[model samples]
Structure formats: structure tokens, C-alpha cells
Target chain A: MARSLTKAYERVKNIDWEPSYISAADKYVEATRFYLPKKALDPFKTFIREYFLMEREKESRHYALLEAASRLQGSNPEPRWMEGMKFALSNLSAIEYSAGRQMGRMARVVAPMELRQGYMMQVLDEMRHTQLELNALRHHMRSWQDPSGYDIALKAAGNSVGAGIFRALAEDFSTCDAVETSLGLQVLIETAYSNIFFVGLSSAAAQSGDQVMASTMLTIQSDESRHMANGYATLMTLLQDDRNIPLIQEAFDKWSWRGHMGFEVGLSLFADYFVKHKTESAREMSQRWLLDDFYGGFYKKLAKYGIKEPRWLPDVIRNSEWASHTAAVYLFGAWPVFYHRYDPIDEREMEWFEKKYPGWYSHYGKFWEAYQQMTDADAGMLVTKELGGLPAFCQVCQLPWIFPRPDASTGSTIEREGRTIAFCSPACKSIFENDPNHYSGFKTFYDLYDGWDLADVIVDLGYVREDGKTLMAQPVLEPRRMWTVDDIRRCRYEVTSPLRKTAGVSAGGSPHSAVP
Target chain B: MSTEKMWIEERDIVGVKLIAGEEAEAAAAVISESYPDAVIERYPAYLSIEAPKEVVFDLRQISERLGRPYDAPTFLVIMSSYHGRINVDDDRITLSSEIVRPE
Candidate 1:
């Protein structure tokens, strides 16, 4: 009865019933990248055209992303940019650019005619984001330094930031089909972190006395929210096929970790150190936006649809308080070599950290005190000489393996492709294990170190000065200054004063100790 | 893996958390009057308001306090965060976390 089934299949293929020269594997992706080709079949043409018009109509409001970003419209708040602001602009610009690239790729990779519209709109939204962020940078830069600083920051820091975005969108690069790309890009990155990145950043901005930036960021968050809704709608459609649940859960685990890694660095730079005047620490903001509002309200509703939470949710919840704080110290310690300003936590600020974070003082209080003494001794301790090498990088997030100490860092170490690769956390390890091919072979800072001298590694990451020094402080303009003892001296640490006795500080814990 | 074990029938509650602001002083007064039995908890920079199972944010009352038109959606910006499903309209925003069973 089943005579020659293999031979029958071969005969059927030779019969040439296929639609076109394009193989079945490549058709859907090639066809749906943007608008379906004018030559494509009947209803698809009409549907794509109609959907395009609707998306254009929806995005008409995105122009408001620019005009004085403060809530009270037409208030004409002055533009301001500091070292932290430069760091933010650099990191944000890189992310927005990567977002546009990812969404454009999503449009090509997604197949269903019904879903193409959402990906297309997200493509437009990401473009609008690029424009909006540029406008913010330009507006503030007019009053700050050279016009070329923008170009310099982008070229210099693009590698690390772009690499982070690339690996974060690993599902997009590696998936055999479309489901995970949309979920990772649209739902996790835009939906979850938008609340933290845009909403929480705006709140922090407003409290720190820049009503302009707050308003602008809030306006951007709404567009991001709409994108999230579109993603949620896509989830609804995917749920119609029960087979998709397991795939969705897998994508959630892979991506939410990367999203967590990304925002931890971006938000903490601003919340913890950059904006001296504080509103919410990164932990509080995560609990507010991601945990309380997002999980409590949004994801709780998704339970009715049978989508379980990410498998790594326990680690995500437990580590939320310390991850960003740890990142702040790591980035701060790395200083001019790293991509942000390193503002020392003054005495009053230390008190606030203890009060706000509870265990924060026990966790990072000693490190900051050590940083204080290091500064007092050299004043420019961050200069190229004192830092022996970069911290060991997590293979997944590209962040340092700098989780809070006194506990072995919780990242899973895996033997993959004959090498021991380290991850920053269990969540990151799961992401790597999900598909090692997507993450492997990329240059970590460790890889960079392996290839070049430490100074060359610094220069490769965009820290180069025209004088050929690898360590240049930010606000990268004509008068490129190095971090001085005076910069450390200004903060109210007693060690900074020559009159005070320097005693009872945990002298430099070798940077190697922080490595996982 | 599920909230069933942690769920308490007696302690069923709905809550809204908001950051401290100029309007919060006036807004809190109006919100308290509506849910007189609601418990309000204040932290360093934010405050939380909770009732038995549902709490209504009256836009009419909020508008009267602020002396201007108020939109339910704008509360998203003013409030830091909230728990429970929120349904909004011109008149009110209701947040409810209770489970409903068929008779």
C-alpha cells in the first residue's frame, strides 16, 4: 500500500508544480520585506497598500517627538547636555539606529500578509525614533560643543553598542522563521523596556530639572507603547495556532535577558551616576514600570491566553535590585576607557544609596570608598596607567561579569564548541544555549584584548584622541581634557583633602576579582 | 509557576501607585474622598492607594481639583505605576484585580 513513497516524492518534485524559481524556504521572507511587489498576487497588493495608508495616518503624531520635550508645550526649556548626556545620546543613538535596522529586517523576514503591516509600521516607528533622538542630540549640542562630536561619538562607540544590539536580536538572525523575531524585537525590547527606558528615563529627567527632555521622552514612549500594542495583537494572532506557544516561551527567555542587560546599562548610567539629582534608582524604576505596571497589568492578562512567563523570571526578579547598580559601578570604574562619565558618589549620595537600596551600602559601599581613596591618591586614577585591563566580558550581554560580590556570580558557564564561554547570569546563559551559533565568533572586549594591546582595545572602542592617547574624557570637543585629580577632589570625600588621614579603606581589589 | 498558591481570598485588593507631584496633593484629596476606606501608603518619592478589590479614579473630581479638563490616559504619566486591569473613559479609570465566577 505504501509502495515506493520516497520514489513517489522524488517523482513529484521532478514534476515541477512549484510556483516560481524561488525556493519554498526563501519565498515568504523575500516577498514581504516592505510593501509586497506591485506584481504580487491580487488581494495581497490591496491589503499592503491599504495597511500602508493606515500606518502613515497613525504615525502622523510622531512629529511631536521633537518640539520642546517638556510636558507644558511651548514652554521653551533651554537645551542642556553634559558628559552623562553625551553618554546617553551616544548609547541611545546607537540603539535607535540598530532598532531601525532590526525592524527593516523583520519586515523582510515576516510572512503572513496580516502581520506584515505591524512590522512595516514598526519599521517606520524605528526610523522616527532615529530622527527624534537626532533632534534631541542636535538641540542640546547647539549649546554644548563642536558639531562634529555627534559624528565622533557614533563612529567611536558604535562597535560595543551595535554588538550588544546584534546579539540581543539573535533570534532575528538565527530563527528559521518569523515568530521569535517579532516577539523579541516588538514585544520584549519595545514593550517591556520602553516602559523602563522611555517612561522611567523621562521621569528621572523631569525630577533632575530637565523638563524639556522629560516631555520629549514621554512623547516617544507613547509611540513605543503603540508598537507594543501591535506586538500584542500579533501575539493574539499567533495564539490561534497552539503550536506557537512553546516557540513564544523560548523567544521570551532568549530576549528578555538581553533586554534586561541592555536597559540595566543604559538606565543605570543616568539614574545612578549621570544625573546627580536623583528621582528613582534603576531598581525602583524596574519595579515600577516592568514589574508592577507591565507584569502586573499587561502580562497578567496574557495568562488568559496560555502564554507562561519566561523561565528565567525568578533570576530576573531577584537580580533586578543589584544588576543595574553593579553595572553602574563597573562602567564607572572603567571610566574614560568605558563609554560614560564616572561621577564619584559623594557622602550625601552614599547615604541616599543606603536608604533607597537597603542592602546597596553593604554591596557597593566598600567599592565606592575604595574608588574615593584611589582618586585621592592620584586624582586621575582612571587615566590609562592604573587600569591594567578591561573586566572579563559576558559572552552574551557583552557587559562585564560584575554582579554584586560576596556571592559567586550566578551566570552559567558552558562548554560550547570546545571553549569555556562565560555568561553574566543564568538568563544570559540560557540565551546563549538557545542558539550558540547566533552568539559565537563575535569579538568580546576580551577577544579584542586577545587581538590587540590594551590601548588598541580602548582605541577600537572609540576612546581615541588625536594625540594618539587611548583615554580621552567625554564632551569630545576641541579642548579634550583628561580626568584630573580636581574632578575627584571636588567631591566631598575626606581622602581628597590633603589634611585628612587616609586609613581603614579596602585598598584596590584587583579588577580581576570582579570577573566571574 | 502560578499565582493560585499565593492568592488570598480575604486579602483580595486592587492598587495604584503614583509619584509625588503638585497635582498629587490635590488629586490624592479627591481620590481619598471617593474611596474613603482605601489605604494610602507613602514612600520617599511615591505613594500607593489600595482598596478591597477595585478603586475608581474620578476624572470629574480630578478635573475639579486641578481646575481644568483631565483625561484618564494622562494619569499614566502622573502615576508611577499600578497593579490590576485598568479600564478608562471620559468619566473614570477603574482598576480591578478580582476574579469573577459565574452564578
Candidate 2:
């Protein structure tokens, strides 16, 4: 059993599972200190509640599988195989929870109940897949090399991937449900994966299709389709919900862009690497069939729901091709360098990219043209001061870094409302616009300094009163003084703004003014 | 004398807005070859490839021709993968997703 399993087992076993799982899940709740503590606290709490529920569901399924596998008598390969499938399903549940957590952080916050219910079903389905896959992999473990190197990287990368997603989720206080519901959750995963990776691997596992590994993926996918339907129904219902229309629109504007972009890392990487190796272009196959049948058909049906096609929909569809091309090159070229610790990108890999992804090679040529000028032979590429941190706003999406740019559209740019919002590309802009409010809510550490509210400034300056009554400002904090948005900019040293300066004296003798 | 015009059952349109590249030329050729009657219109950022009949919007092939990959999330990918444009005339269909606004 994995160390994580032992840890999880310890955690879950201690919790009383009677009445409701949420009762046990409540122990995990911890407070996050924000500048405006009450403004979005309730929503954020609700958001985390849903997150914990999903986490609990994942823990429950994992232990159940371990228990079943341990009890099974070693008889036929069938029982052993079943154990592997259970393990795979358990892992997938974890993956879904991770994905959902990231999605929430993107500010496309789903209501606690809605997210809990939807994810609960998905959690069960994913568990089913985990069990099936683990069963198959168990038999092959002795023959197969221990998958630590790549597996560890995949897990680590996958975990960090959601952090950016959560930052995006933290944006919106309302309308998270819309974002979660809009995309047919299962269909979105199935169509994207099927087009990119799932179909090819499943086809290869025909003999062992029922052996656990293959069965797990297929079973999960089958369950995913149902989840997708649920997501679709929920979205449709939400859109039609007179109370939820505006919220739905807001959620769509935020989550659609972030969610669409989220598909890039896995979808593009798998499509270019795995699909191309299968002798068919992932982009071509998906565009010709899966996307049209799933993504397209689903979008078309939205007309009846009175939901306008999302602003990002057009761009997501358009740029998917480019994303695939970039995925082929980046993962193939960069994976060996960055992701995998084995084999430098040699002539063979380059040759494979050229043959399989000729377009990416030619396009990346431009990037390298500029890159070579800055990079050294020994150090490789140098990180410049200008490239230090992501700009206050997202370049493409304009919402923030919570949303990422698509694979190939990295350098793509956009402009919004006279503000030169540089997105990694145009696709992000579409997605970003889908939920500007959510993206706008992504306050940086610097926001505390810039806000006119004296209380906000004091808290931002890292000054806290022991009694929680008064905060003293520090003079040396220059880093926090830096401001964004020329209009909202304020002085760091003193309460210079006329409104606050006058209000502070009038309201009370204390230099601190109530935050507006 | 009255002339009888032929009735068209379905005039589905497949369109692509190609970002600048060598793929621009390749996309054009593919469009011309696959969709002979396609209406090709050029813009500063992208080339709009539109056809009356269905045409495959293969990003790999297009980018292969152009030399740059579509890097970010954009409507182009979804459009290429999915079919049917937003008929702005229809107000009932909500095109909004979690992160998108309706048309």
C-alpha cells in the first residue's frame, strides 16, 4: 500500500461515518485569512465544503478497494485483476477531486450542494474505474517496470496543475454552479480523452480489456458519459432556472474559459504524443468525429436552453488544432528535458516531431529564433527580470494567471476595453471574457497595498494588532508598495487619498479608517 | 417564363480563422482543394476559411502548413472540432459556459 493510503486510512478511520459523510468531512475545514474577510467568505467556505466532500468521497473509495483486495483469496487471475481495477478507480477519484479543486479555484465556484452531488456521482464512477484498472495492473506489476519515475512526475505535475486552477476559482463568489454544470462533465472528459488518448489505449487492451486496467478506463469513461449527461442536465436546468440565468451567465463567462484551457495539458500532450504514435492524427480524428459528436452536439443543444454560445466556445474549437500541434512538439521535445528524467531530446525525437508534427517544428522555429538570442549553451534558457512573474492580469484571458493559455497559442495576444490585456493568445481572451468577474476577483498579494481601504492597506502591510483592534503600518515594506492599475494606485507611506484622509479624522481619532 | 430554382436541403458551413503562418498558405490550399467553392477572406490576425459543405479543420495539418501551433485556449479549436457557428439570430440558445458569456 502507498504511504498516502496509510495516511488516508488513518484520517478516514478516525472520522465517525454515521449520519452524514460531511459530518466527518467537517474536521478538515480550516480558515483562510483574506483582506476582505466577510465579502466572499461564505462563498469561499461553501466552495471548500464541496472540495472536502469530494476529498472524503475519494478517501472512502480508496479504503474500500484496499479492504476488498486484502480479503480476496489468491485463486484465479480474475479476483486479482478486480483488485487492480478498484485501485485504478480509486486513483481516478483522486484525479477528479484534484481537477474539481483546480476548477473551483479558477473562480468558477460551484455551489456546495451542486458540486457535492455531481462529484459524489462522479466519485463513485471514478472509484469503479480505479478498482477495475488496479486489478489488471496487479498481475502485470512483476513484469512491468515499477512506474515510479514517470508516475511520480505525473502525480506531482498533476497536483501542482490545480493550484493555478484554484486561483482562478477563487475569483467568483456566485455562479460556480454554472461553470460546473455547463460542460457535460463526463462527456467533456470522454470526448477529449477519447480523441486524444483513451480510445487508442483501450483499443490496444482488447485481450485485457476486462483484465482490469482497460476495463477500468472503459468503465470510468462509461460512467463519465453519465456524469457528462448529469453535468449537461444540470447546466441546462441552471440556464433555464430563472433565478440562475444571470448567475449562469456569470459562471459561464468565468469557468468556460478556464475549464477549456484546463483541457490543454492532458488533452494536447496525449493527443500529439499518444495519438500520433497510433498512426492517426489526434486533431483530425477528434475534429472529424468525437468533438463534433460530443462537444459540438452538446453546444448545439444549448440553443434550446436559451444559453448563448459561450464567448470562448468559438476560440476553444478553433485553437484545439493548434493546441494539438503544440502538444506534439512541447511534450515530445520538452518532456525528455523537463518532465522525464531520461534521455535528452536527441535526433530521433526531433525526427519524430518533424515527421509526426511538421507544423509544430516550423512554428517553433520562430520561438527558438528569439529564444536562442537569450539562452546560453550551458545554462540553457535564462529567466529574465521581465519574465520574473506573470503580469498582474492574464495576457490572453485577461482574468489572471489562474487561467492558462492553450498549448500552441502561448504567444497569442488580445486587447480588451482599452486595457492591453496580453493573453498567451486570443483563445484565452475568449475564455477569460466568459467570466471577467471571477478573474477580476483574483487579488494579488499587492492588492492589499493598492486598495484605498486603510484597513486593507494595514493588513496588506503585514501589520496586525494583537487584540485585533488596531494595525500599525511599517515603513520598510517597499515590495508591497508597488501598485497596478494607475487609476486605483495609492501611496504606501501615508493615507494620502483625500476621501480616507478626511474620513479618518472625522470618524475617529485613530489613523485607521474603516475599509469601504 | 418562370424558372424553377433547386432547393438546398442543408447548407452547413465550416469556417476557420487561421492565425498568420506558413499554414496560411497550406490552409488555403487545403481549403481550395477540399472546398473548391470556399470563400477565402484575409485579415491581419487570421484568414477566414469558409465552405458551404463540411471541411475538416485539422489543426496539425494547418499548423504544419503554417509552422506555428495554436498555443492557447481559443474558439478556433472548439470551432474546428465542433460544427455549427453561433447563429446570432437565435437568442434562445445560451452559448454560455462556466467561463464564457452568451452571444
Candidate 3:
């Protein structure tokens, strides 16, 4: 009665033809080092008609929920998560859009019909994900009690210092080899790490009383399996030739570190910091999803093909121990620069953190104590200034060098062509060394605003509300008196680059690098 | 087959994470019926159905259990994430730790 999907997919794939007018090199603009065989597997065997029908059904269901949520205005969403969404959704939408562009690039350069077909569907999936995030953002903007941050979300993704991490990630994957992009993004990020964000944190979203975000994350994650299939198909095709093994290994090495720093660290922050009622700590989630599931379950199987564990797996394990806490410190320390309303972790949360991460209070306790004291605008103390200013962002990862723990930072500095470049870890340093030209051109946050006044930087970032004077960011969710541009000016805090101050220093000489 | 040639490992666990809802409950019910050894872990926001080595989702069975028509695409809507290699046809979707060699 109905045409078999496998037969239809095979028939559709047969339509692909070799062009006589142009060479294969010309047709595929980007060249990959990984050898791709002509034959590839499409495990899903996705066809266009079925794909559209499926996507349409999913979209209708999602939009219907969105409509219901809008009309009903039922749940009392946690303000902390709602505020965090301004930052999270902004970067997520941009990342998804970048992923869409990457899919287009992969579809063009990758020769296999099956892989290309999957990539085409993924292009639409990425676009849909972006729209879904934007819609969630729009809903929050319209519904949330505080809308200042949501209004400038897209703008913040471009300018916010913390957002540089995600931007670097998107840029790295988009610019790398087409096949490597699939490995980095789909296989590593989408398959391995995204569950922490989409599934694990979607639970956090629900627990935080944001059903819309929960729905959005779950729906977006549904599409990721297909994307993962696409990556697997490509990897399998490449693996058919023995020549591609080393190249694949190298890509895995670089991306494992990159994906951790750029993506997982941020998700960890959201999980640990954003959600009010947290079930699992970021460390615990990493243990379950990343270490146990991805590595033990999926990657161990790849050993048969001579694919070894990622070179940076041990380093990633070490970094994951303290990544979220360090990230939380960075975000809270430089709260004025970001667009979210932060709710400082209380005694309850502190106890939880210490329980989850043993001895957490020893390293971070003082900072939170200092943060609480400085919340009052009348105190004339900016926490950024109090904490001896923000550390230098790694040239490659775009995260601060004060990682794992600021006390025991794995960060190092190298003098390249008379300019000093900082790296968060040896992995990032090795990545930079591998292709100095690729990462060298990018500028850090301090490079742009080293000597500028704090107020001026905020104004320049356009993180101010409609009044154009009051900052969109507040020290706390609800302050007795909101800190304005004038309040920041009153504090007289000047932006200083740690890299600029310690230019020629070899390694681990950064000031204020002692917090975990 | 020799151990080295075997794509599937003894410790390999295939799983599907479904958004917690009536549909997920129904799917879990169907899966538990077929794979008696399946481990179903329920969370606040999702249901995790895991089986060692391999698991299969037959839409026809799911439809019958759901008391309505269900399709592969609709099943995908509930499944947020999965572990192990996945293969999907119109009526059936299989997740196995074993890598199916390409023809």
C-alpha cells in the first residue's frame, strides 16, 4: 500500500549525477584531508517527503504548546532561569544558525549522496532549532516579569565577553574541515555533550517551572539523533579508507578539548548556577552522560576500528571537576558585563555545592561573601574591582585562563611573533600551536576594553535598557536600588587586561588566580 | 564471530530518552513488553529506557498500545536522545550497540 522508505531513499539517491562542466574540486569548494569513499551509509534512510511530514508534525505540536503557554500563562517560572535564558537562548540561537551554515558547507564539500542527504535535512533542522530558541526567547521577553535582558539578546551574543566562548566554538567548527565539522559538532557536541544541555538541563528547566524551554529543548534534541546519524555516516565513509584514521584521531583530539571548553563548560554553568532545584551537579551529569555513557558506551566501540580515546580525555576529566565553579565565578565576578540578573547562591546552595563538590566552600566561599557585601549600590564596591578584575581569556577557547581552579590553573602563555598569547590548558596551547594562524587573528575581551571605564564598556555593549542609562544587568535579581551607569561610574572601576600586564611572563603568573 | 570482529560489546547499553508524558509511558510499556530485561528509569522531565546491546521500537505495537495511530516520525518526537547506533525505517526503528556493516 505504501512505498517502502528504504527503496524510496535509494531511488532518490540515484538521482545524483557527476557534473561534466566543472571539476569535482570546483563543485566542492572546501577540501578535507580525510579520505572519503564513494559509498556511505544513511542509517536513518531519511527521505524528503517523510522528513517534511515529520518536521511539520513536530513544529505544529511545539507551536501549539507555545500558544497554550502564552494564553494560559500558567506556570510561575523561576526568575533565575528566566534571566539566564536571555544569555543562554541568545548564544544557542546563534550556535544553531552557525550549525545550519556548517551543514550547508558539509553538504557541498562531502561527496557521498547518503551523507549529503542527511546534511541537507540537518540544514533545515538547524534552522528550525534556531527558530525554536528565538521563539522561546520571544516568549520569555513577552511573558517574563523582567524583559530588559531579553530585548537585547541577539545583540549581546555578538558583544558579551562570555559569549566569546560560544562564538569561538561556532567559528572554529564552521571554519575547520567539512568532515571535521561533522565530528566536532554532530558526533562530539550533539551526540555526546548536548544531552547535558538539552535532556539533563531540560529537566532542570521543568523543575525551574519553565515548561516552554523544557518543550523546546526536548523537541530540538529529537532532531539531533538524525544529525548524529549524519556524522556517523560520514565517519564510517571516511573510515573505509585506512588513510583517514590518523586525521580522524587528530580531529577528535582538538575537538574534544574545544567542545569541552566552548560548549560543556557553559552548559555546566547553567546546570549548576541557573536552575534553582538542582537534582544533579554539573560534575555528576558529566559523570553520567559524558564519562559513563558517551565514552564507556559509544566511543569504546570505536576501538575496533583503531580509533583510540581522545588525546585530551584525561585533561577534560580533570577540567570537568572544577569547570562549572570557575565559570560561575567568572560570570558573577564580571556581572556588570553580562545581560542576566544574577541571584547569588545562598547558604542552602552553598551547602549543596560543597556536598556535590567536596570543599567547594573553601575556594568560592570568600568570593560569594564579598559578592553579598558589594551588592548594595551605596557600598560603592564593584565585585569585578573587588575580585582584582577579570583574568585574561584564553586566545583559543575564549574562556578565562583561571580554569580547573584559579589556584592551580593549567593556563600558560607563549610569545608568538613578538605577541604574547594565553591558553586555558595545554590542549588549547597545542591546538594553537597546530595552526597558529587560525587562532592568532582573534582578539580577546581585554584587547578591546583594556583601559576603558566599566560604565563606558557597558554602554558600548548596549546592555542598557530603554532609558539608556540604567544597566540591564543587576547585581541581584531584585535590588533595593538598581545599579545604573552612574553607580558603575561611582565605583570608578577601570577595565584592565591581565594578559597586557603579564605580557612576557612564561606561565601561571596571573594575579587574582587563586579561586577555584 | 570472534570477539575482535564483534562490533557490539558485552557492556554496551542502548537507550532512548523520551520526554516524560503519556506517549513516553506508552512507549516504555511497549518496550518493556518486548524486552523484558529493559531498565526504565523515570526522571522529573524524561523517561530513560535502556537495554543491553540492542532494543527495537515497532510503531505498529506502539500504536496498538497507545490506542491511536503512531508513526516512526511521531516516535522520534518523544525520543529526545539515544545511546548506541540507530537505524530507522518507516514502521520500525532499531538501536543497537552492534554496528551494521554497510552493503
- What C-alpha lDDT, on a 0 to 100 scale, does residue A124 get in candidate 3? 97
lDDT value, candidate 2, whole model: 0.36
Cα lDDT computed for each candidate against the true fold: 0.54, 0.36, 0.86
Give the runs in model 1 whose Cα sits over 4 Å from its true position: A1-26, A30-81, A105-114, A145-151, A161-177, A375-388, A404-407, A460-462, A465-471, A474-512, B1-103
**Candidate 1 residue pairs in backbone clash:** A33-A108, A69-A215, A69-A216, A379-A485
lDDT of 1 by residue, A1-516 (tens): 113323433343233233588875575444321221111111111123333443353344334434434234444332222556655666676666666666666555554443455566566767766666776666655534433344465654455532353344442434424556567766777776766666556655655555545645655564564466456555655666556667677777766766676555456545666656666676677665676555665565566657777776666666666666676666556554544334566788888777777766777776666565554323434322333334455677776655544244664455555555767677777667766776776666544444344444555565554555524543122223454324433332221111112363222332234421
Candidate 3, A1-516: lDDT as tens digits: 156887777777777789999998899988888787888888888778778888898899889999999999989999899999999999999999999999999999898888888999999999999999999999999999998889888988888998999999998998888889999998899988999999999888888889899899999999998887887788888888889889999999998889899999999999999988877888888877887778888777788888998998888988887789989889998899999899989899998988888767888888889889999877779877866777878899999878888777888888778777888889999999999888998878877898899999999999888888988999899999988999999999888766564445633356335353
**What is the lDDT, from 0 to 100, of the residue A11 in candidate 1?**
45
- Winner by DockQ between candidate 3 and candidate 1: 3
TM-scores, one per candidate? 0.68, 0.44, 0.96
Model 1 CA lDDT for position A494: 23
- lDDT tens per residue, model 2, A168-241: 33223223432443342333443334323333334323233232233334334433433443444344434534
Worst 10 contiguous positions by lDDT, candidate 3 chain A:
A506-515
Model 1: chain B TM-score relative to the native chain B: 0.77
Model 1: residue A482 alpha-carbon error in angstroms: 2.8
Worst 10 residues of 3 chain B by lDDT: B1-10
lDDT over C-alpha atoms for residue A253 of model 1? 70
